[model samples]
Target: MEGGLLFQFCNWSTLLVCMVIKVPQIFALLSAKSSRGVSLKSLLLELAGFLVFLRYQSYYSYPLLTYLEYPILIAQDVILLLCVFHYNGSMNQAIPYIAVFLGGWYLLALQKWIIDLAMNLCTFISAASKFAQLQYLWEARDSGAVSALTWSLSAYTCATRVITTLMTTQDLMVLVRFLIMLALNIWVTATILRYRKTATKDE
Candidate 1:
């Protein structure tokens, strides 16, 4: 009983931590007043990734406290997307794109097998999305709009998640997903710091 309670405590704490970590990124975007350093594609792809994960949650036999956190994660991405739109001065034009993407993803959630496939696809997209963004950051030689604190917190959160996941479940697929996220977060954090000089010069 003690172990179970501890596990539950860790689970809830981690979920709350994840939510709080994302807040820094949102604030970073808002403060930057430009999405120049941040990758809009990455934000969108991650939103899709979270939706796929959310669908998978419905099919997961065991109930998880973190499952409830998916919508909050998605909402963070949406806010970032809106920030992107705001920075681009194209909020109205971007609305339909967001709507259509959500509609298509929602349809895929209807079937289990499709959701399974989509989860993998979106995970890949989410991983690749960070790489794509890194490429943009490299070429642009600017990380002005990207927050080092955001990536720092994200990397730390991903690491915490890996530990929590291991304690609770032995699901291979889930482990792989978190591992990928951790790797990407580390890469982004490193890339941001490496380019700090150039990004500052550019600004």
Candidate 2:
């Protein structure tokens, strides 16, 4: 097998691993019935990030793994959305947000000129939105609302990302995106641990 094909295979394998691992998160939301701690804005931001990633991926090789990721994310987000509304008993209120975000992502994913200076701004905003979600989890005393399995999958993917960064050099955007993901995973993990310690002390 050539290097590109081999890398694709690895990417697909990792993607499969992510989906299977993320199932626990979906189950946690469903079984616990508590999306109260998760931030709606964070899901919106993630949906936006994946929309950007999908457009950027189109300009590059797009391993099979790329195809798997966004759909799984979409599914989990849907589950989380339902859980959030269910817990709040505000299903009607959540509907507009969902429709707007879904429609926005669909529209954004259609672009051809993949890179713009605005992408950096959008990506940073998305990252900051995850911080909002983190704060909610801490304030509400609910790690159950967050995705534990996604964390484990991220830990695994961190190494894979380093390799991926080395794999292809055509699309600077793709490389940059993976590196951003790598950095976000590191920061998110550290923040979670730090918050856990503080919460532990308060208790």
Candidate 3:
């Protein structure tokens, strides 16, 4: 009974966290009126990873609680993406991105092998997203519009998912993906904090 309760807590908490996961970052962008430190490539890659993972879970009929937060995460990402494009004054470029994402979504489930392959690659794709952001931070030397709070919350969600995935699916692929994501999220959060401190010191 205690284990069940813990599972529920982790699942529900992950959902709650994801519901507002991107709000801080979105607010940061709007407040700064710039996408300076935000990486569009990272955002796009992250969104793709989310889509692939969500579809894979659904296709395999995993427990709803195990993957429930993904839709919320994806929606938040879409809003965040729009904000990035708006601030970058490249809203027109968003069309191709949307088209590709939609197309890829439909194609992922076209065959079992495709999604299996995608799931295997999902970890790397997601990891790449993190590295992309880290690269941007390293290059820009500023956290300008990147919210450390958002990344910290993301790490929290990933940690909870790691627990929940072990409790429920126990799928090795899913477990590994969450583990990688948790690590990457923590790394990104730390990088953002370090850059923020440097920016403050330079001020």
Best by lDDT: 3
Model 3: residue 115 alpha-carbon error in angstroms? 0.6
> What lDDT does model 2 reach?
0.63
> What stretches of model 1 exceed 4 Å from their correct place?
1-6, 198-203
Please report, as a residue range, the 10-residue window in candidate 2 with the lowest summed lDDT. 109-118
TM-score for predicted model 1 compared with the true structure: 0.86
Per-residue lDDT value at 30 in model 2: 74
Worst 10 residues of 3 by lDDT: 161-170
Which residue pairs clash within candidate 2?
A: none
- Residue 124 accuracy (lDDT) in model 3: 94
Candidate 2 ranges beyond 4 A from true positions: 1-9, 59-67, 109-118, 137-144, 193-203
Tens digit per residue, CA lDDT, model 2, 39-117? 7777667666666655555544566454456666666667766777778788898778767766765665455443354
C-alpha lDDT values of all predictions: 0.75, 0.63, 0.93
For candidate 1, lDDT tens digit of each residue in 1-203? Answer: 87677667756766776677577767877787777788877777777777877777667754667466677777777887888888888899777877877797678867778877887786697798788788888888877778777777766666666666677666666678878988998898888888897656766
In terms of lDDT, model 1 sits at 0.75
TM-score of each: 0.86, 0.74, 0.98
> Which scores better on lDDT, 1 or 3?
3
lDDT of 3 by residue, 1-203 (tens): 99999999998988888889999999999999999999999999999999999999999999998888899999999999999999988999999999999999999999999999999999999999999999999999998889999999988988888898888778999888888888999999999999889989998
